[model samples]
Target: MSIIVLPQAFAYPAAAVVSTFWLTAYQMINVSIARKAAKIVYPQMYAEKAQAEASKEAFKFNCAQRAHQNTLEWLPQIIASTLIVGLKYPIPAAALCGLWTASRFLYTFGYTSGGPGKRSLLGNTAINAIVQLGFILGGSTYTVYQLLA
Candidate 1:
């Protein structure tokens, strides 16, 4: 492998770690805001015995939503990054890595605010395409380089 490619190969995993940190931060902030909003809106409901159960359920739903968002944001990046490292395609891998991170951000914002479905769907599709394309291109390039060498 070229010396330049070596560092780029390492960057794929590093980018994944950065993406994970971003996702976790986003989740924490989302849950915190949701919990605060729920508490303010349903303080009386939370206090009343009959309404307490409903409040609890609401809280649980908020938590679940946050978790879902986190998963949606991080899972693709993890998969793409891992593939990049394993397949040895730094350029496409890096591009996909960036796409995964960007999509996750878009997805998180869209999901949190209940934005239009098209935004989230587009983001998801873009990330998926990047990962798939990376895998194909990286594998092919690696094979060709090996044969030529």
Candidate 2:
């Protein structure tokens, strides 16, 4: 069996991955807190639409849960981009990953903030995440080209 060698720059991307994991945990904690405040019982993933419409607490909890759920949806791509692009372009990948994580944090906060127009509150935050993805994709493309060249 051949030993695989990874560059030291990989450390940065690895740390970014760890940060994303912690972010997930943090979002979970927010959901738990919101659930308690909203009296959302265990086994129910969300408040009913009518209940949420009638109760501010329920709306808050739903926002928090949605924020966490959205993060989970994007997580695989974040992890994959960080690691795959880091294989050949570690620093740039890590930078983009860090930005992506930060953007996600803001997006989650905006979603859970209980402000007007829940999603519209911080639409730019999503733009930031998308921009980071573009950069990560660029890095990934270069990495792939290098690997196959």
Candidate 3:
């Protein structure tokens, strides 16, 4: 078996991968928080959902759940594209990865806050996420096209 040695140039892509993992874990933290909040605000043994909906804390918990769900939905795509795009385009990958990480951080706060206070941070919520998605998807697509063509 030939041992393939990746050079220092691969560091950036590796960092991109690590960054995504960090984001995933970070998002999970928010999920855990929301779960705990749901239990606290709606402490019915089997009516977590129903009780959560009725509680005044519903808005905050719901936002947290939504943020977690949104992260879950997008995570697969981000990881896939980040891996592929990072290999061939590490600079852009790193930048987008950073943006993705930062956006999730802001999203966690904005989501949990659930009020006008969080609204002040413009790109803190979604704009960064969209930009990250665009770059990751666009880069992945372009890389595939280039390879196939």
lDDT of each: 0.55, 0.81, 0.66
lDDT of 1 by residue, 35-108 (tens): 56556353332224444356664444354355556566556546644554445555555555666666766666
What's the distance in Å from true for residue 61, model 1? 6.3
Q: How many steric clashes does model 3 contain?
A: 0
Ranking by lDDT: 2, 3, 1
Q: Which residue pairs does candidate 2 place in steric collision?
A: none
Model 3, C-alpha of 139: deviation from truth (Å): 1.0
Candidate no. 2 TM-score: 0.88
Determine which window of 10 residues in candidate 1 has minimal summed lDDT. Answer: 43-52
Cα lDDT tens digits, model 2, 1-149, are 99989998899999989999888998999999999998989999999999899999999999889888977987887788789888888887888888777777777777888743655445656666575568556766777888899
Backbone clash pairs for candidate 1 read none
Global fold similarity of model 1 (TM-score): 0.53
Q: Extract clashing residue pairs from model 3.
A: none
Better of 1 and 2 by lDDT: 2
Top-TM-score candidate index:
2
